[model samples]
Target: MEVAAKPAIRGAASIVRALEAHGVRYVFSIPGVHTLSLYRALDDSAVIQTVLPRHEQGAGYMADGYARVSEGVGVAVTITGPGVTNILTPIAQAFADSSRVFLIATNLERPFLNRLEGNLHELTDQLAVVRPVVKWAYRAMTADELAPAIAEGFRQLWTGRPRPVYLEVPLDLLDEATALAVEPATPPPPSEPAPHLIEHAAQLLRNAKRVLVFAGGGAVSRRVAPLLKEFVEAIGAVVLTSLMGKGALPEDHPQVAGAFGYRWSPDNPVVTLMERSDLTIVIGSGLGVRTTANGTMPLPTPLIHIDIDEHEFGKRYQPDVALAADAAVTLSALLAAVHAGARPREGWTPEEIAPVKHALRTPPDERTARYVPYLEAVRAALPREAIIVNDMTMLCYEGVRFLPVYEPRSYLFPRGFGTLGSSLPTAIGAKLARPDVPVVSLNGDGGFQFTLEELGVLAHYRFPVIVVIFNDSTHTAVKVAMHRAYPGHYRDVDLVNPDYVKLAAAYGLTAVRVASPSELEVTLRHAVEANEPMVIDVPIALERYA
Candidate 1:
């Protein structure tokens, strides 16, 4: 019998094989000249699903959204130069939010890479473009280096501090023949705090009369959320989730102070709780400038900050005890120490927590009051399991402040990067990742214009996402700021918006406008039941959408 011959495989094919080995299910991509070979390999692969987005930015945001919702890392493929530049915003957004997005882009051929000969799609240094944003950036110089580089990228993306990774593959490398069996490498386990540190932190928790646990986006993972719940209950500590950490512990839980509670101001009830607490445990949070109300919020002592990155310990607020460890690992060890033999005393009782939380929830401010009915409609129409992505808009600011998120991964916002026009494509990628879960995209007319063409991608795929446009016909957030600064003076802030209904109709999607909350609830219910793509345009003055 004749010996069997091996199948032909190129460097590009090896990349696909590596992705398959890593168990990546989806890749958001845009086809371009230099990346045709990778696309061809992706087309041949049966396991990986390639999604084409209208713009490179959409592709990156989609990958970010997919990473946020799914258990695995998200992948995006693009060509060199413009493709890389187009994707920087989403990459930065993902980095800011600590989402795991693996960006694979092509570069000029090896010979002409730095020749300054105006090679097609040439960038002097493509890897440099993404270095500040991505956790790691690499340029694979040879066919043999591709698999190892990919393994390292995944290792960085999944372990320690999770963030985006950028890998640049030169065009010439794709021509080399290869048969490397690149099996997936095991990612290192999460880091645990030292025993002495865990015990010392436990002593603080046990001895303190009042304990406050402040969690951020780092605690939102499946491995970490349950530990958080157990830890909070074990110590009877009052829990407050940052906006990015929303839904990490169910908001309905009596222990959860409130979403974004104490994140904004000095006099807020949540901040008062922070002020009075004797011991505060900061988990998976860097306490960045925005989350800490631009550093106006005080750091309560004796503060113990637990984070995967040590550099974050003193960046925004100083900590008395800084534990550099993974949230889940540190939380697990801390819980064990707290539960060792002697039970810890309850920090805040239901009676105490109730009043503070009630204050946080009550007396909706002017901005929040404007969004209540519409938000209630959105909440009433969708199931508890549904996921909602919020854009950076006036409505969304209030939405994140008041939205009751009961499950991990159920709520998403552009928290760190604070980008506008993020929700639509993000929701599309989310719906694609979890088709069983209902998705809604909330945006203001002004921010929605940034990625308006992405609506066409949603229409083409018919992803059954309800897109709600709060049409004020101006950048309400900026306009409000301008009023504060200039008082009775405005310049070029107003906009002429397209008729959203007609625009949706042209995209072959169901379009409706509602003027009342009841109408919005009813129409959204119908749309959900029908499982169809829809656009609900609610004019801001009238506050209606369906």
Candidate 2:
């Protein structure tokens, strides 16, 4: 008697197997008709945890955040056309910041294409829309190709300049089952820095009287902070981190100058140092517009830029010595070269760095009736080891500038995407990853509203997250900027907010609303000391913060 053969895996099942082989343990998605097959496939997979997001945008942001904190690729599955379109903002952000993510989108059946003049959720070209925002895009044509396509997508997302990759599979292909081998693809090794290039970079640092090291989002890797801290100490170089790179070195460290770019005013000393420095050694930073004052195109200082992505090497600002290498490797090499050349300078003491730090430090009396005293309160309330997640808004600046992050990945934000509604959910993911540390979600009211539904998720899991909401009662950042551009006219911008404290309480979480700066410290302290998810809504005047 012939033995029964193993049941053939088809369509969604095969795709699930491919994902498992890729080591994707968690996937965030919003169910849609086109993706129902894939969704069904995820039903019985014990290895994969499927998180159902309230909105497609939230799904993408969740994946983006998970990828950021995990330092690995994250997956987002969405239906074709409109579902895919809804996630463009997060996709663009992931691309901009070199986030490693895989967006698996299910498209309309190939045979049914153009059957309707303008079908619902039909796009003239979905790939074209996503091309500008992804590292790579593919439309799988066959069942056999699905596994390899996913493997390749994962490979692209992990190699060199890690970024989000989009893959579209037609609904028809989802039903076809065939025996296919899913093989894991190996990502190309990061390019190594040249010996001479390292020597030249070290030479520039040695020759300059006031050398400044500027770190960017690309530098916020597992090994980057320690490497950067060691290098800064060894050379006695003044250090500054971009808004996204805040935690690249410990903020309390004597060498840290401050943050640079938007939210951080151009007049800030960090920007001043960039202007005054004889040499600016930029490491692992893309020097993007947001981080570089929309390319303020600062001084003609000699520059040595090092990053893993070659496209980012001299794209924004040309570098005198551009080395395309892994951040950790380049930093290590530079540290060795710097150690051989010079001893720590006596003049570069902690006291010497104090004046700049003091100038940049938020003043105790800076609080106004309208703006919440975020920096002062957070500085006082949060523990030294708390993991902070900052949403995309003015709050990001305050959080990074004020919060003391001792290591890389300690702080999370959408520097590249600048996407709102990420703070709370990202905090949940971070808390799950690092349960020992206290996690705080720092967000503006507008940003918080984007994924406020996640409060239910937080409540269900009983994740202890201290959510600090800057309740400005409107999108103050945009409204103020609009007023600057068009003084008299009111476009539909200001939003009336709900009672966030009540909303939090409805979800079985503790909540408080602080109306004055005086009340901020006590409220924040109480929230931090709580055991369950809590929201501290601080009513603020947006105008003052602006």
Candidate 3:
């Protein structure tokens, strides 16, 4: 008697199962011929939620934004060649910001690999192009290797210096069947803090009088805020946060100095404090070009760098002492050591720090009667907990400066990538992710035009996201920057905008256009109360803010 053959599993099926086992809830993608196998597998499985985006790039950005809010790995699936290339921008942004994301690309058949051959959707050295921008890039050669490759990708993504990972699955391999019994891989154990390194870091802090703490994106973990607050208060050290680390500490806290880089105001006090400090304790932040202004000058102080990734230390800037440990663990250990060597302190008072805080708190005085009314209207209409997503325009800078964020992640913007069309989709994702919280997307006229189709997605899903379009009728940010660069010359930067209110209504969403700023408050309240997807198109003078 012949034994029945075991059920053959496709490589794509194995990948889907691996992703599900790794706890990935959502997978965003734009379907193509190369991804048909995976699409079929996904359709057959009930483990993962799949979303189809109109554009591949939009899908990638949605994943990136979702990861930012969810604080977990986000996955985006795409076909080979153009599909994979289109997502590079979002993937690069993820890599730059150390965001956890997985990009699964379905490649052409193995016979057509890496040659100038005429195979459909074939690309020469695709993985090479993506390697520099990802934490790890893997190409599975066989069905048996698929599970282990995916497991490795997850390990690399979650390990030290977490970032986006890429896995390219060839069509031939995806179509092939296997009989191997794939056992689920065990996840690695969490890393522990080095006791000796913690003691050394503590000793440096205890001896220093003018101590400062620079917190980075990696320091934004859930427990980091309280741990940092405790450590800083114990050491009497002034605390500063990077742009990504904003709201890590309460802005009103006495020990909090201010945000270090990416300040709305040029003369930010945290920059001044960094320049004067004697000892700087950097926690979980890589002093990258943007964070440290391209490393033009060090902090003019002895630095103690603490992070999970050892390779990050002394990469761009030198450190006096480096502790390769998780931020929470290292902070906990350091706090204990510092408390043991407690000393009395004498330093600047709250009165001296008041001016710095006041300067940052001052609103932009674009006080045209119209502008004043508009600002007041928005402030009065929106709830304090409303999540505000801004576009990469002068309105965004104005919003960041004037609009208050009462909580962390409440203010979402593409600061690292500075992508224009991100606000609407990001707001949609944020609203869907947290239905109870009200979401407001502030987009410029130019930015809104890029992804206006997303309004249909909002309407279809019935997501109640409030969109406020700043109708300036131009790429005002570019025009202003060009004017400053040339001193007088104006180029092709102005634009003619459509009636956005009508555009919103066309997508089956509630829409209203506000011309006089006096109508802003009533219009906003009506939109909010409607409790449906709505747009409040506000016509504003760009010159006032820019």
Q: Each candidate: RMSD to true structure?
A: 2.8, 3.3, 3.4
Task: Report the Cα lDDT for residue 321, model 2.
Answer: 94
- Per residue, candidate 2 scores C-alpha lDDT tens digits across 254-285 of 88867643454456655555555677788877
What TM-score does candidate 1 reach? 0.95
Candidate 3 local lDDT, 2-111, one digit each (tens): 99987989888888888888887788888898888888889877879887667777677777767766667789998999998988887887777777889999887877
Regions of model 2 farther than 4 Å from truth: 1-7, 114-120, 261-266, 271-277, 294-300, 342-347, 362-372, 482-493, 516-519, 542-546
Q: Write the per-residue lDDT of candidate 1 for residues 1-546, one digit (tens) a residue.
A: 996766657998889989899988889998988988888888899999888889999999999999998856889998989999999999999999889999999989888886679677777777787799999999999887888789888998878788999899999887778766696879887787888987778777767878888888888878888899998888888888888888788887988887754248766777778877888888888888778876677656888998888888888777878899988888888877877832345578877888888877764566457677888888889888898999998767776656778778888899888898999999988888789988999999988999988888878888898899999898887777778888777778789999999999999989999888788899889888988889999887632221
What is each predicted model's overall lDDT from 0 to 1?
0.84, 0.77, 0.74
lDDT of 1: 0.84
Off by over 4 Å in 3: 1-6, 180-193, 260-266, 271-277, 295-300, 315-317, 342-344, 347-351, 363-385, 398-403, 515-531, 544-546
Better of 2 and 3 by lDDT: 2
Best candidate (score: lDDT): 1
